[model samples]
Target: MAEPTLHIGRKISKVRELKGMKQETLASELGISQQAVSKIEQSADVDGEALEKIAKILGLSSEAIKNFSEEAVFNIIGNTYHDNSASLNYQCSFNPIDKIVDLYNEKVALLERLLQAEKEKNELIKSK
Candidate 1:
């Protein structure tokens, strides 16, 4: 049976896709071939050292990639947008849509900060 833990390779692939990056780009960053990146993404497990390298290339922490969850993402979006207090009042043709875009941009920035803090904590723990 599978351990039900996060598959590191799959998470890597997901992040790469969300960032609009191709396997070849990741390979170039890692100084490996596209085929190598594809092979790496096939395995369920990646070495911790290699994972760290991949994380650096992907602009994420190794721990973040290992612990990434889609539910948490949806939860964030739901929490941010589901608040009626923050809801936009649409009186114009484009204002409401622009407000939606603003909300998403704000949420993405907030998430980035949180991710950076998590990375710092992980680094601190590693140094301890």
Candidate 2:
């Protein structure tokens, strides 16, 4: 069987989407029109120089963009989230409520210091 052709444009589009970018945004970055970007996204292949520019805008190497796979990305994300040894934990080690209370206490302490300083200024004014 003949090897299937790689849709470079589609890979670029998927990478752009994964990066939360719009075609208009990519167009602006490339100094091209939105229609041009759309056309590129629909193309089966892209030239090396244009591909380099797109890869740069997407914050990846040309090879990375060329080899981009949605399945690989999802697999990595899934594994990262599921593997506790992967150091990608989202759980907070410290209590958020405690942190909020600490911030509130600091603000209160600052206000108290300001109030004491104002009282001192008032006492000085009275003596004058």
Candidate 3:
């Protein structure tokens, strides 16, 4: 079996895609070239400044990128330790993207409700 990769690039790419941002757009925002963005997303050892720029552009913290990985914990442990010491396993049920979407939707619903209430109040005042 092969070693698990950190997949920092994949995380960056995923965040960018979720935000509907193109590589060229991110590069332009960071004053870099499209190729630089591409390389950053593909390489695990990208420059710290570049990674910070990517995180800011994607509205994600650096810690988020640090924890990004495609491989499961079991796979990671198996690859790192075969028949050796004890291993730990963990599972994540919540997705960050889903949580973000839910929050945004909730905010929008609240705003709509407030607007409706305000409009009704205005109409009542006008009729008085």
lDDT of 1 at 99: 97
After superposing candidate 3, which stretches have Cα over 4 Å from the reference? 1-5, 69-128
- Write candidate 1's Cα lDDT for 1-128 as tens digits: 34535677888998889778999999999999999999988778999988999999899999888888778767878987864655576345477889999999999999999999999999999999
Candidate 2: RMSD to truth: 4.9
Q: Give the residue spans of candidate 1 off by over 4 A.
A: 1-5, 82-128
* RMSD (Å) of each candidate, 1 decimal: 21.0, 4.9, 13.5
Worst 10 residues of 1 by lDDT: 83-92
Candidate number of the best lDDT: 2
Q: TM-scores of the models, in the given order?
A: 0.61, 0.62, 0.48
Over 5-119, each residue of candidate 3 has an lDDT whose tens digit, in order, gives 5667777887688679999999999998999889888776667877887788778887777676545544776797775445355444689899999999999999999999999
lDDT of 2 by residue, 1-128 (tens): 22223888889999999999999999999999999999998888889999999999999999998888878998999977755765656588799999999999999999999999999999999999
Question: Which is the winner by lDDT between candidate 1 and candidate 3?
Answer: 1
Of 1 and 2, the candidate ahead on TM-score is: 2
Q: Sort by TM-score, best first: what order? A: 2, 1, 3
* Per-candidate clashes, comma-separated: 0, 0, 1
Q: Which ten contiguous residues of candidate 3 have the minimum total lDDT?
A: 83-92
